[model samples]
Target: MDEKTLTISVEPLEDVKRRMLASLRGAADATARHTFASAELMSRTLTPARWNILEAMTGAGEIGIRELARRLGRDVKAVHTDMAALVTAGLVERTAAGKYLFPYDRVRVHFEFGAPAMAA
Candidate 1:
């Protein structure tokens, strides 16, 4: 089976708008992309605990929150809270059966900082 990939990036809103317009114009690629408005936002959303959750879920198939918590050795309530945040961020999905899934086999993060602007 082919490996599914999710691309995460920090970008300005204008760049996101341009990309959306391009996609509407049929210039879209097959890969899934998630863009954050800024690095700080991305950092805040994808915290270390959340990253651990993603790592555990990747390619793990649909699992109940309790099982996921057991696997992570975390409290069910904490896991559920993180899962809710992840679902809201579109990084995870909730099945009809109420299980959680992170469908991608791989995650690629891409972002860069340009040189600071010089004042005249």
Candidate 2:
């Protein structure tokens, strides 16, 4: 067998350290941020392909419809269909690379609405 062994220890915090820990431990954690209602950034207004395009753009940070289709395992026509919708919605931006720019912060409203969020 090819293997290695390692050990680790845990430390318990004291008063001031505990206070700092509390500050770091936010009341609104991942659960709150990712809630269906709160985390529902993509608009239902999008067509299915548009949704796909949006997801691809926001997750992959700008790529052409052909490449997007390649990643999506779909046809270029299909990907473009969605891209058209996404562009109309202003959720995805076309670039010189025939790619897209997500512009997530531009569309985010505290809860990240109207644009597809990072991969779930």
Number of colliding residue pairs in each model:
0, 2
Best by lDDT: 1
Per-model TM-score, in order, reads 0.93, 0.45
By TM-score, the best candidate is 1
Score each candidate by Cα lDDT.
0.94, 0.51
Report RMSD (Å) for each prediction in the order shown.
1.2, 15.2
* Ten contiguous residues with the weakest lDDT in model 2: 29-38
| lDDT tens readout by residue for model 2, 1-120 | 322211111222353356457668873322211112222233444546665555555535557667778988899897777777666655556788766776442122233225657796
- Judged by lDDT against the true structure, how good is candidate 1? 0.94
Which pairs clash in the backbone of model 1? Answer: none
lDDT of 1 by residue, 1-120 (tens): 999999999988899899889889999788989999989999999999999999999999999999999999999999999999999999999999999999999999999898999998
In model 2, the Cα lDDT at residue 56 comes to: 58
Which stretches of candidate 2 lie above 4 Å from their native place? 1-44, 105-120
